[model samples]
Target: MVRKAKELNLKNNEDFALWKNFLENVGINNFSEEEVNQVDLTIGIFDKQKLLATGSLAGNILKYIAVSADSIGTGSNFNLIVSELIGKLALKGIFHTFVFTKPKYVTSFQHLGFKKLAVTEFGAVLERGFPDISTYLADIKQTENPVKKTAAIVMNANPFTLGHKFLVEQASQENDLVYVFVVATNAGLFATDERLKLVKQGTQHLSNVKVVSGGSYMVSYATFPAYFLDSPNDLIEYQTTLDALVFKNWIANYLHINTRYLGSEPLSRTTSIYNKILKKVLTPEISVKIINRRQLLNGEVISASNVRKKIAQNKLNELNELVPETTLKFIRENAAILKLRIKKGMKIRGN
Candidate 1:
């Protein structure tokens, strides 16, 4: 007999509760609060009143998948569920998609069009069609945009501090071209649009730098959740490794990016772990540089975390010293709005 299935609105309390309970029963509880709310779409097969199988997508990345024990024998239900998700994405012109799953389900995902991009100790990151990347490369090769030596830096310059400037400046100086991918997801104190603008203003002085958005490809389950969730160490390492692998295997190849640059992370364990994984996963063809974190006059580290703390304690003057002049202007210009957001539970956790 065919199973009953339908799409769900997570904003609906009953649907949300059912989904959470289903995941809890299946022992798959590591996603962040943001992921829970940001689901682009979710569907589940139900038996009577019980949710029998379920899956969700957040910007082309498949996540929060679980199936009832009774449905685990074969790939029929699995194939149907994923095929529909891919269909949904395709309807909207999202041909390329990715999935992060524990190693046990890699075969199940492979049965559907997903190919293994990379596998880590905790999980395997897989993908279907990768769009745009190839087109970007083709456009470059066909014209004068052929950069001989290129570098990449994925940053969440939340407030665009002096430290961020130092890293971008260093990358611009060393590489013939630098692609600065600002994290595009709106999961920070300052919205992504503001962050993008700040990065552009801060890096405008660098003649060789070009700033771009990391559109659903940069921060995924790996480095992102570790910042907010009580994530397992294995997931933290694996997710981070996979993010770097995608860049080295795909983005680096497409845009002639031979180097990846990052500011040395001294405080955040998540960032430090991500930096370590990038170094190890990137091939010898691509160079990885971890610039030392910038510091202030009192010998203290110049950090976004410190900047956030100072703001919380009403130390605007001190924040000015740690960030670039551009960032300081942004903070002041949006002070009233910032207060409302921060007061309304917006967090300032270090990126």
Candidate 2:
């Protein structure tokens, strides 16, 4: 900013429209109502009368930031807002913070000691050190007798499906060992614990298949911001590449994984693109294979989203064709709970 703001403003709704408009000018549209409501703290840097630069922090993630085009060259307001956000976090004894921003802003954050944890063409996830990838990688319980040609699958089995089962079965049969890392992020319809349980029971028959929590390294808000945004594009590429990098640089080596398996995403465009990005990012040492999605007898592809839609629409019989017996059993066990969630009109992630 040529003329920086003197101080930050209090959290109020008066400046929200201003904030939203600013972010929109930068080609960003993911800021949702739920996320805005989650903001427990927001500080806008004002240039006396006008809001020149502003941002907010919630759940330790910095977001909803925008700056005037004129302020692009000046570091004054950028530095000011970041310092204020960090200071607020520090007051709470929070040493770590995460920032979700565009690729263009990575350098500004780097100057503030933030590490580039994940970046995609559309969005970049940077962290100030609240449990980075290395921290998550350290938590994995490697097999005692690690297999030489190990395969890995990172999935958020939002109730687990036959498609997921098929992928696991193939990986396990092909490789000496397979690690099924269930995504631990808490954004899905089912809680992480529930998802983990379902994934475990659904894939328990394969002795070579190890079902374990992804521990925040896979599809996590830390690496993928699209989890928060529904309409994601080009940015998914960078995020996926960063994901593969984490696996190649960290998880792959630790777990003796030379091959990462993925089911061909026939449903979500973003995921389909992400699969392509993984092809480019995964080094030659590690092979990535995209398996075809399992299909129903009617030829429709099986997906968790399809399973959820069936449950939501009360088409229980159709699910029999879309899901494995194990998943069907689990859904039956939790029928009432699933029904209640569906009735409440909760936005269940079918994917």
Highest lDDT against the true fold, candidate: 1
* TM-score between candidate 1 and the true structure: 0.79
lDDT of 2 by residue, 1-351 (tens): 244444333344556666666667755576655566667777777665776777777767787666667755448677888888888889998878887776788999999989887566666667786666667666664665776779999898887888888889999889888889998877766789988888888888998888888874675623444423435544455566767776776788777788999899877877777777777888588899888886766788788877788878878887887777877887888888988977787676646
Measured on C-alpha atoms, candidate 1 has an lDDT of 0.76
Worst 10 residues of 1 by lDDT: 221-230
The clash tally of candidate 1 reads 0
Q: Whose TM-score is greatest here?
A: 1
Once fitted onto the true fold, the runs of candidate 1 whose alpha carbons sit more than 4 angstroms away are 6-42, 46-52, 57-61, 64-73, 86-97, 107-111, 115-117, 127-146, 220-231
Clashing pairs in 1: none
Q: TM-score for each prediction?
A: 0.79, 0.77
Q: What C-alpha lDDT values do all the predictions have?
A: 0.76, 0.74
